[model samples]
Target: MTARKKGPPTGGSGANAGAPDTLEGLFPRFPGTKDIRYHPVFQGGLSRWVWRYYTHRLTRAGRWFLGLTCLLGLVGSTSLEIQTYIPFLYAFAFWTVAGAAAAFSRPRVAFVARHADRVCAGETLPVEIEIEQRGRLGGADLNVLPSGLPIPVDAIPEGGVPVPPLRRGEKARVRLGLLCRRRGVYVLRGYRVETDFPLGLLNAYRVFGEERSLLVYPPFHRLARMEMPTGRRFHAGGVALASLLGDSFEFLGNREYREGDNVRDIDWRATARLDTPILREYREEFFLRVAVVLDTHVPRGGRRDEREARRAALERAISVCAGITDYIARQEYIVDLFAAGPNLYHLTAGRSLAYLDQILDILACVEENPDEPFAVIEPQIDERLAQINSVVCVFLDWDETRRAFVENLRRGGAGVKVVLVRDAPPTLDPSGDERAGAIPVIGRADFERGVEEL
Candidate 1:
């Protein structure tokens, strides 16, 4: 089972493809769906009746018969043989009338395209196309031919999807398993329903317009349990490192009590001496706010293979960001995603799965920008780091540039953990000590292990 290619796989911009924010509009039309712009009728080369007859009347069998008749007539004239010419001409004349009759007697049918509520990249979806009679058309045989959508939509058992002969007003469903090759909200335009009923010698097909659409979410992978580190206690500027109530042992200071302050923090010893209600303030004790910054700028100017490898690496990075975002949000932490390319994608997601959906939605269409680099968004990351306790950066490359980025975050008082994505396997201490600090250059194969250990 295989569905036709999901959409125009060559580019996301399909014909009539609307804005990315709203994937609305009918999809592009293929060859069979193209209306006759200027046929012989329009140019006055042939009458309208003859033009219409030529459109769907000539089948492969009919055309072959006519060609054989002309060949036989030509040979018979050269050899003066009336027997071969007369038989071939009679056969062609019989089929010509049969094809003309078949063209006007197309089976009346209606159709509906059905599939799963949602699909993701690499997942196969079964599109059930139900075909029913529109009128008193009964017990008709149809040779349904399908034009590929942007993606692959394969008919079950190959050949053509066969529809069983149904009683008048009855319906039959044909299943086509379509594999989603990419992620996006795709609009499947139409299917060509061809029929050569009664006789297989003529062609008769109608465009069954099916304006169905499906959304493909970014592919997700389940990872092992992970614990992200909240940085060491630091209090300066408006930024509060850690939570309001971190470890009880790591007390920062004592301040006047306020409403909603935990009663357990009421320091009776300081309250009596100061003659005021004093509450113990602990560092690194608040909601877990993680800054998830993704690097999405594709490296430019390289060999064709190198560029392709780097592009693939960026997609993997996005997938890593998606998995990590879900993981962090699942932990009841507030995840703020920061990535700048064609658009500056920023989302602050809480523990709710809806927020995770929002993040994945944005990541599904996130493409790298060749113009913007990590430097262009460093300022934004710095601003975000000033408010959050921890920063998690997923970068496309790890060089002096990224090392410096890590160092800056370290100085910002926010606990910094970096995930570096590269094409080659990481050469370092399995102890994760070869590179000082918490930057783990994770390989594609060892993503789970590296992230888990981190």
Candidate 2:
């Protein structure tokens, strides 16, 4: 949520800028009528009513009927002056006012409450709205404008029937159905509460705005790389350490000797008394962590081609990171994410499945900036390399500077996996020997195939 800046108070913004003399002076004053009620007003009694009937949507047939009615009405009032028709007009006016008053007496009403601001994808949350009558009145017809989400309804009208009448001050709690099908931010717009009130002759409506936002994280995806080092000890060359018994690591409970069991694993002291030999073991040591770096900026090339290439690259990077995080987490190893975008994002090492959602949320909103260079942030990335066991760099370009940075990371005893977003020519040394001491440079195709293999 963004912070809101406070502005000058309401009273300070107008000509009557001085503080209110009394508490009542501070509040808004409505003119004349003591009752704060709104009623639909119409003009010209029968004439207006007849005009409205004539204008019941100007179709060809409707216009002909309207002309015929006007002609007949004019002929029937031939002896009566427009003034002589006062009594009839008065009666019509009285009936119209009475009808409007009756409708307002039981104005249909609705109130929104218990709204949920957060929900996960594919999850349904119940929204509550209270609808009631305004005064000592009863209303039948009610309708909601700009309908809500398409979720199954839990409760219909109170009775096992539709269109139930509501009494004055009596309320019905409505549970609006809500469903989320995708992840990201969702904004809830205002609801249009409406009702026909006492009669179906006229409809009344009101707009209700209760601003809300929801942040949804992406769903989890499985990691398939089994050979990837997990929570296991590795030498400088990234090889898992062999577990040998009778070593100084620690002494675990002895177990029965099996075929091909190493003699060094045998517990000789236990073997002397018991007929069978037992082996001692220690808990495995683990020293593995992964640092994921996503490069956000894509350089200009062909318009669509560059965009498609950049998009493909970003996807590959996200896929690789997801796989690595899942694989490492499953194996009890820690993983962290570092984004080299206009917005710098860093998540510390964690071993839970929950972090996957967090990482994906950040990835979903990540975009490239033309001015930012992935190389410019190398120093900060280097600073974080001390604790991370491996650095996975996902970038579009691979120049000498980037190559040196990767080489430096490797020299600093950190494993480096460079997933190039674009294809790179075979790496050549300063001496022009393309094959000697060339670091493994996986192109976009290579990375895609690698992920599939994993």
Candidate 3:
């Protein structure tokens, strides 16, 4: 969620200084009505009732009929003519009959839904629901619909999945597609079974209460290659960190068996030839460990358009982070991802210990922070800097705070690389010293065209 600036509202310019304060002035134009929908006043009372009545209770055909009735009634009242009154009375009678039918048409059924636990954003998730008839009457013309989705209603298909006619005590399964446009965790309340059986004018539905959660991972590009300054660090546990046993230890040479050595390490052949008990010696493994720091902070208090632009930049940075993670995973290096949004997120994977999916899960749920995220991330990195071979910072802006953070990491003796996600090309290098190396800026157009390498 975006943080709201806390202060008094600003006044308009000189041309509009004398304008009256009205509803329009309090609520400025925005791309979406999310703020209004969650407002305290709009959450309950008459406003919410009206919204629910129009969206959920009224069907498309019902809306058309009601509109026609109101229009005819107004015309008849103005003209005071009996002929105009006939059309208005007919519309009103039909609307009353549809409402009465819908009131008594609620279906009695039970639904069980099955779907994957996770999916990628911008992909269609197929859900299969088994609907069982629980009433004495046979059911027909039933429509299965998904409820409590995090996306808009338009994301679903025009007509929901159609279920086959069922007899008493019969069951039928239907499949529906849910298109998720954004990445996040969403709880699906249940399915809505409705029908416009006789007149197709009104819709009566029953909402089931089967709750299920799904995680949507952010979609990312496939990088052909990635270059970074890195080195090797000693891992005490080596492969044992992922698995307790197996080929975790490296063979060095045989030595005379010591009294405290385990029997499993004894070399029987060497012991017989030399007439002495011998044991195998091994060394701890050393591997590359890279830290990927994602910048999630976006300054608050901007025009709606500017805020949206910044949000887009943040998403681009997330995708880049995913790409880097994938590239690093392919190289068999240990990955440590650090990000701060509303809270701090840290994960260690790669090198057969964990998969890239774990890191994507973090990226999916990371939000935009209005406060300084570097402050939260610096301490975490400092604690593990000794074990980290290199640091890759993905930033939305090249400001002083971020620059100083990266410089500090480099000064602490860790290899550092910088990536700036921006909507446009940079005018100048933020770091004046050429010896510090150039930062690669990925623009919005470049992401659209597809980023093959970095």
**Best candidate (score: lDDT):** 3
- lDDT digits (tens) for residues 18-126 of candidate 2: 3222343211231111111111222347744443333221223434544554555565477664554455455456447645754454344756557655544456656
- What ranges in model 1 sit over 4 Å off? 1-95, 143-148, 151-160, 201-203, 210-213, 232-285, 353-355, 425-438, 442-454
Q: Give the TM-score of candidate 2.
A: 0.49
Task: Quantify how close model 1 is to the true structure by its C-alpha RMSD in Å.
Answer: 9.9
Error of 2 at 273 (Å): 17
Model 2 stretches with alpha carbons more than 4 Å out: 1-183, 186-190, 196-203, 226-284, 300-305, 308-324, 352-355, 395-405, 418-453
Instruction: Give the alpha carbon lDDT tens digit for every residue of 1-454 in model 1.
Output: 1112233333232111222222221122112222232221233435534444443455657667667877877776776545776776787687777767676767678877777746666777777788887756574666564443443232333335778877888888777666665665555656666666656667677777666655566565655665555853343423232323233246899899999999998999999999999999876445567888888767679787876667677766777787888888777676788777666667777645246667766676566777645676677777767667788888776666666777788788777777777765444432354433656566667653444544
Cα deviation at 170, candidate 2, in Å, is 6.5
Scored against the true structure, residue 192 in model 1 reaches a CA lDDT of: 62
Tell me the whole-model lDDT of each prediction, alpha carbons only.
Answer: 0.62, 0.49, 0.74
**For every candidate structure, what is the RMSD over all alpha carbons to the true structure, in angstroms?**
9.9, 15.0, 7.2
lDDT computed for candidate 2: 0.49
Q: Of models 1 and 2, which has the larger TM-score?
A: 1
TM-score winner among the candidates? 3
